[model samples]
Target chain A: MYAFNYHRPASLAEAARLLASNPEAKLLAGGQTYIPTLKQRLARPSDVIDIGGLAELKGITEEAGGVTIGAAVRHAEVAGSALVRRLIPALASLAEGIGDPQVRNRGTLGGSIANNDPAADYPAAVVGLGATVRTSKGRAIAGDAFFTGMFETALEPDEIVTAVHFPKPEKAAYAKFPNPASRYAIVGVFLAKTASGIRVAVTGAAPCVFRATALEQALAASWSAASIDSVTIDPSNLNSDIHAQADYRAHLVKVMAKRALAAAG
Target chain B: MRISMTVNGRAVSGEVEPRTLLVEFLRNQLGLTGTHVGCDTSQCGCCVVHVDGVSAKSCTMLAVQADGCSVTTIEGLAQGGKLHPLQQAFHEHHGLQCGFCTPGMIMSAADLLQRNPDPTEHEVREWLEGNLCRCTGYHNIVKAILAAAQTMRGMAKAAE
Candidate 1:
């Protein structure tokens, strides 16, 4: 990792000040992705602000018929939390199915969504459940508007994500075809029946997590796995690499969506 | 940066670069060579250790990040000069060949058993996903973990 000054700010205000003063300072949440990037010399920030220990940014709270999870809450904590399991077992399952025990232990929800890796599992959940991303600036961006593109979000440079509020879904499930080696989703799908509507979010299939509108519509008409069986997925915009072809990814998207729906049921 | 942490049971403090990994700090600075670094990319769980009594990849974490946190490495597993139950079980079950991944596998398995005592074989296998053992095919390792869980349970019952 590159040599950079590390600052452990006790408060979000201090962290924001550090980021504002030092234009190149990066907030270190879990260091799961950022550390690796630094080690590879991919990024060279002037300062690294550590928010891992900030008490204000670490917790899960059930309120207003939804669960609000702090940004610094680790994946392992979410996976192990009885509250998360009781409120949203599918979210707990999704957290459990992330990278491995060790990775889950250290990877934070804030870091995961902020990095916005195209293949990440959390994006599917965030978009599928229509979660609200709350930033330090007291802005609440809807899940649909938060994710802009691959490795991109609506967050400004210094703006920090404080918490994510996920409404209680009638039923929700996430299914992923993970790469054997990395355990990242080759094509993951998250299905949820919410008060707003039935939502289907597909991850690791394109530049960013996207809603499968056709599948969502089909499921809305009839909440069944077979409902979207004939709904064709377009391969034109899907990702194609050595792991899988565009057409293959499109096919996996459909399969995973169906699986997610069945699992949700 | 000067950071202090409880390793094993002793509080140790040292000056280290901000970018230094916890594994590097543990092995190089603290001379705790039991935590090995097989894959620096965090894929291999060779550097698995307990941070604040929970299993974490030391290689993926910065030494500075471990400030004021208690860490436990494989070297700390044995108590009173006796092998930990997991270690003994591994030996009895012939869980290793090259011994390269033993330390990490033992640590990860220990954490798993702590969380879920008397875990099923499937649970043990799933828990070992992060810890890779190319030599053993994980057959003996799984057996060792199960055996250790049984022994630990028996010991706990006797103590109770």
Candidate 2:
């Protein structure tokens, strides 16, 4: 990593102010992705604003309606959280399934969502569960609109994700086939409830995580394993990386969706 | 950066560079060479340590990030010149060969045992998926952890 000025701000406003001051600044979260990028010299920011020390950015909160997770909370904490296990075992299981223990211990939700790795696991949950992304800029992003493209989000350069609000779904599950080496999802599916109806989000399939409209509609009619078994996804725009081809990923999406439905049951 | 952390039951402080990782701080600054850095990416558990009682990878975390936090490393597990049960079990069961991954393997297993004392074979295997052991095929390591669990259980019963 190149030599850069590091700032540990005690408050969010100060961090935001620091970001506003330096347009080339980067917010340092879990560093699962960013740190490696920095080491590879892929990203060389003049200022690194370390967000790990911000107390407001950590912890799990379960409220009367739903759960609001501080963005910087570690994946291990989410996986082991008693509150999450009781309310959303699917989310806990998903966290537990992400990468290895090291990745889970150091990776943060804010970092994962912001980095938007094509194989990441959080995008599925954020989309399928109808979660909301709250930013330090005081803006809230609906999951659908939050993810724009591969590694691209609605976040502007100066904004930081402060928290993620997961609306407690009636039932939900996430199933994924991880790239054995990187532990990234080869094809992942998240099944959950939305205010409108049931939603199924697929990640590691396309340029970004997306909802399978056909599967969602089918499952809406009959929320069952059989309902998803018949749904065939089009593979025109899926990702074909080293893990798998577009067709293989497409096949995995359907298979994972059925498994997710089965797990949800 | 001036960082202070309670490491392995000792309160230690060090002035580190901003880019210094917690693993570097522990191994380089404090001369606690138990932790190893296998991959710069956080994929490997070779740098795992307990941060405030929770197992965390020291490589991905910065020393400055650990300020005021309590840390327990592989060195902290032993007491009074006696080996930890996990260490003893690993030693007896041939849990490692080159010993490159033993510290991390033991660190992660200690955490798993703390969480679930008597884990099923599947549970042990699932929990240990994070700690990769290239040398040992994990058969003996699993046996060791299970044996350690039984030994601890016997110790608990004997004390009663």
Best by lDDT: 1
lDDT of 1 by residue, A1-265 (tens): 6799999998999988898899999999988888889989999999999998889899999977889999999999999999899888889999999998988988999999999999999999999999999998999999999999989999999999999999999999999999988889999999999999999998999999999999989988888767888799999999999999999999998899888877987
lDDT of 2: 0.87
Q: What is the TM-score of each candidate against the true structure?
A: 0.99, 0.94
Query: What is the lDDT of every predicted structure here?
Result: 0.93, 0.87
What are the TM values for chain B, all candidates? 0.99, 0.95
Candidate closest to the true structure, highest DockQ:
1
Clashing pairs in 2: none
In model 1, residue pairs whose N, Cα or C atoms come closer than 3 Å (at least 3 residues apart or on different chains), thus clashing, are none
What candidate 1 gets wrong by more than 4 Å, as runs, is none
Candidate 1, B1-160: lDDT as tens digits? 9999999999999999999999999999999999999988888899999999999989899999999999999999999999999999999999999999999999999999999998999999999889988897999999999999999999999999
lDDT string, candidate 2, A1-265, tens digits = 7877888898889999999999888999877788778777798889999886689898789875678889889898899899898888899999998877767877899999998988899999999998899999899999999999999999999899999988888899999988877778999999986567999999889989998999998988988777877887888999776668899988998889888888887
Residue-pair clashes per prediction, in order, are 0, 0
